[model samples]
Target chain A: MRIEAGRASRRYWQDLWTYRELLGFLAWRDLSVRYKQTALGVAWAVIRPAFTMLVFIAFRKLAALPPSGVPDAILVLSAVLPWQLFSTAFSEVSGCLVGNANLISKVYFPRFLVPLAAMATSVIDFMVTLAMLALVMAWFGYAPTDKVVMLPLFVVLAACLALGAGVFFAALNVQFRDFRYVVPFVVQAGLFVSPVAFTLGDVPEAWRWLVALNPVTGIIEGFRWCLLGANAPFYPLATLTSVAITLAMFALGVWYFRRTERGFADVI
Target chain B: MSDIVIRAENLGKKYRISHETAQPYRTFRETLAKGFQRRRGSAHQEEEFWALRGVDFEIRRGDVVGVIGRNGAGKSTLLKILSRITEPTTGYVDLNGRVASLLEVGTGFHPELTGRENVYLNGSILGMRREEVRRKFDEIVSFAEVERFIDMPVKRYSSGMYMRLAFSVAAHLEPEILIVDEVLAVGDSAFQKKCLGRMEEVSAGGRTVLFVSHNLGTLLSICDKGILLDAGGCVANGNIRSVVKAYQQKAGSGEDLAPNLIGGPLKSVTFRQVWINGEKLGGSQFSPGEPIQIRVVGNAAEHLPEAVFTLSLYAEGGRLFTVEDRPMTLHQGEFSLQVEIPAGLLRPGDYSLALGARTAAELATPHDWCWGTDLASFELNEVWSANCKRDLHGMINVNARFTRENAPILERAAT
Candidate 1:
């Protein structure tokens, strides 16, 4: 082991690879801890998105919102699935550093693994919710179009967005701690702002660009398009914008996390 | 020649001590105010405390090096830097082997996880692979003496059991260089002895070890070399015996025995001087069963009724014995109190004195005036008398008298 000041980013990627087992263990620990004492166990993961889908279904009907020619429940679940992944991943990643302060202060590992592993837990939750969505579709006798094969690409996009934002917020939370309060607000506001309860087409055409700025908008609409068929339009321009923005966020988060990681043990 | 397993060059760690707010997490209002102050070029003053500064050392392979220092002496900081837990603010350290640090036992053990699961979790956290943990799993369980409870959640285990399990995992770690920080102080004495034995075994296998502990006797026994740190810098580095002796002499010197006055609501009384037998005392040696006198001189800022002064005596084994509270009314200015302890009571060991005072009205806050633990320490030595035996068992001398049951009084002999 060679330790030098201001050389954190030098071999960080290789170190992360070496510490990959830590990432797996951390993710496993988080998932186990989450469902350990709960009466429902892993059912809690599916219950959250299921309840969210039901609430959105009720809201869509009360608002008399126009549907995208698909079953309302399917439409809501598809959109809500990615949003659940994003929100959970964001919240877990943001709090990862402070939550594992003991490990950070006492042991040496690539700090990025903390937020990355926390994001992995949310990904696990997303997969469980996806399976639930599949069951709901089977009940509705809705066979997804051949486009469903393209869904993994969109899942990766959502994961990247969550990890990027989570890494950034994790670093900020260590210093300001005001970000802890800010994160919940962002996740809550994101529920309405992103195209979670409704399709991006339902958004007025003039303000659609503003919604596209939110990467999750592209992810939710993309999920719907893949699972519900082309009835959910795949706007190439909007998807490209979302992809570009998500990658930028990921890069910025990594840069900021590495910059602040050296100071975590000291300040934290 | 043995290879140099570790080398630290000019390592330093600096921390900003914020005085503006006591809270570690700043509020939004404070952050905003700080931003405004920064823009105006008038920021809050923060003192920088160098936990370690310009420390340099080299450890050869198979050397068991002990790190000795007083609290806040930067020993932990140096270990942290070497362990890569924190980056040094300056300089660097190079190690040529796999390094595992046990800064504390059970560092990442989850209370809710079972022993079987936690062993894996802790093993991985210590940088062990899955296969390594699996291979050594049985040994760890047996070493901890928790084979029957291995499947049970650690939260249900007693504290001793938990500590044993944690230490067992760390002991099984096969790092070429081990860094341990006072973790052997956990569990029972038998477990501590087992841990020390395990560490010696590790060192005997030609692996380098850096151990930090306040237990001077243990360090002297186990360490081949010692590094003494004082005020964030290395003061002495040499053979274990001399290093330990230097630390003890420096620690026992009378210069640092001055009482530290902590300001509070009841700051009316402050310690002016503390003396043993009319001499400043810092780890002074006294003969067993000899008459020892402690004189405490203090100043009262104002007239006070119901002022009670107490001197608490503490043995090295953490037993506390307090002198009777001397209640006295004091006018403004200086007052002195003398306490005498007849010698034959204490055994040959280290003892410390803590001074405290409280008013009847302020009984709730006993430390309001002059509370300092281990502020001045002295050692008791065994002195042989013509009739008294030199080697005695346990801490106090009773001077027992013997009598025969069916015979004469045996000349009324005392044993």
Candidate 2:
């Protein structure tokens, strides 16, 4: 009889590929569960950001915040689309490890999939939000720009930034349940810190250097650049900072997640 | 040898058992103070409590090994390490094949999902491919007896149905190594039997199984080898029967649970004051005519003394019952009381027991710590009456008295 194969070193990448089906299954399961027994159904996915955009419109027109070069509605909608996607993705993934503690504790799989699949569910919402974005842009009579081609690139950066930052929080969330309370504050703090409704030009020259350091400044500007077609867009330094920050966060996130993942099952 | 499917050397796991400060830095002051007092130890002095220490073992392919242990033993830690749920603090383990674990059924069950969907969900969790799951779906439903309700959301099913569905999926996944931990206790007797049968089938089909359970009978039936883990370590390993025999010997005779089981203040404080005032009294054993006074003196931390103090005679197979108050009334605290086990009621049998505690509240397990795992058991052996046989042990009674005076003679003469 042939003996069983011995354990191999460095089978992680292949194993990840092989387990793609599980990731698909987990994401699908989450979507199904999220929509199940809901009154408004999937409309909430569209309505959640749509409602947030309304809030931004109020902040602009009623609250006397100036339009950031584009129509108040269009600018707010675009920023909200990305912000909601990132927040939803990050929040879902932050709790993903804890939510799957049972599965994590019982069996072995590429743990990257847990967080990845968590982020995957938000992709559904992201796509839905994209539909809303295109509909709004069409209604607003804004022509498509060449910068639009780079939209997907900035989108990837946004996801990488979220996925990366979310990993550390998720790991810490398990050990310190206080993170649950802290998470909402961080999300809110980030909103004020990012250039969601305002343009980078709105910042005084004195603080532009500081604002440039914020990873989201690059991302939001990248998004605006893509949408507005370089009317005053596409700074190389900002893009570099965005890409660098995204990479740094992704690298740190993966490492921190892997390091803390070893204890997740027990601590969770 | 099947290339030694599992191997471990010097594996150790340390857990910080704490119910205090969340982070390593205890306080803001501590963090700042430590930097100034650099000569002092760091701000975070985490206590290292090791759960598993230098645990080493090897299992060949197709070996069904039972891991036996008392509560707080390292059984779960070992399983967690082998399952790759957590990492060891030191050393390493190597596995030659894919391993699956059923730490509990429905590990990620979404109650809203249909049974059919959950089957796929649970199978995916065990790392089974969809095609593999689809192939086994029919068998799984049939085994779980949930075929008719497979399309319905699991939340609607009885808990029994949920457990069966969950277990069936795990069973059909067919991983190379399966680790089971106390999941058999979920379903009822028939389902447990079915699960045991399925476990046998899997091992027979050549997959290695590692099982942890408190039920000795179940372990003895399924496993060919046994490993007994004690407090944070393995005390015995090897043949199942021999190890089980050694365990039984270690257990000794299950008797004499006085202080450990019963929690209440005895006649201690204020007895001198009350004894002189004729208010307090204490005694161990009392005759039927004697007034037995027992004053329970104890204080409960959070819970009030709300359980009924049951004074009863138990003989033969069950508890012969009596109670002074409803269980809800007795909370936790220092309390003492008077109890009377009515004279001549106890038919002699070994019944050594003192009052423990049980609440109507739902406890996780019978052996769950709050329930008090092994309570007091006392022995009772005394002759009550000639006609009263030992066979009648349910409720006890001494002697029913009947007297015939001179007036009865006239009535007897007429008959």
DockQ of each: 0.62, 0.24
- Per-prediction TM-score, please? 0.81, 0.73
Q: C-alpha displacement of B270 in model 1, angstroms?
A: 13
For model 2, report DockQ. Answer: 0.24
| Stretches of model 2 off by over 4 angstroms after superposition | A1-9, A63-70, A203-207, A230-232, B1-3, B19-39, B42-46, B253-415
lDDT of 2 by residue, B284-392 (tens): 1223233323233333444533333344322322345534445554444455554445445555433322243443333343321121212222223343454454555
- On the 0 to 100 scale, the lDDT of residue A152 in model 1 is 97
Residue-by-residue lDDT tens digits, candidate 2, A1-268: 1111122225666878899998888888989999899899899989988888887777777657654567777787777877777778778888888788767767778788888889877888899888888888889898658768988998898899889988877887767666676778878887888777666776787887787787877877777778876444666777789889889988998888877665666667
Docking level for model 2: acceptable
**CA shift at B96, candidate 2, in angstroms?**
2.6
Positional deviation of A97 in candidate 1, in angstroms? Answer: 0.6
Q: Which residue pairs in candidate 1 collide?
A: B289-B343, B289-B344, B290-B343
Query: Which lDDT tens digits does candidate 1 get at residues B130-193?
Result: 8999999999999999999998889999999999999999999999999999898788967887
Name the lDDT value of residue B215 in candidate 2. Answer: 56
Q: Which residue runs does candidate 1 get wrong by more than 4 Å?
A: B25-35, B255-415
Candidate 1 C-alpha error for residue A52, in Å: 1.0
Interface RMSD for candidates 1 onward, in order? 1.6, 6.7
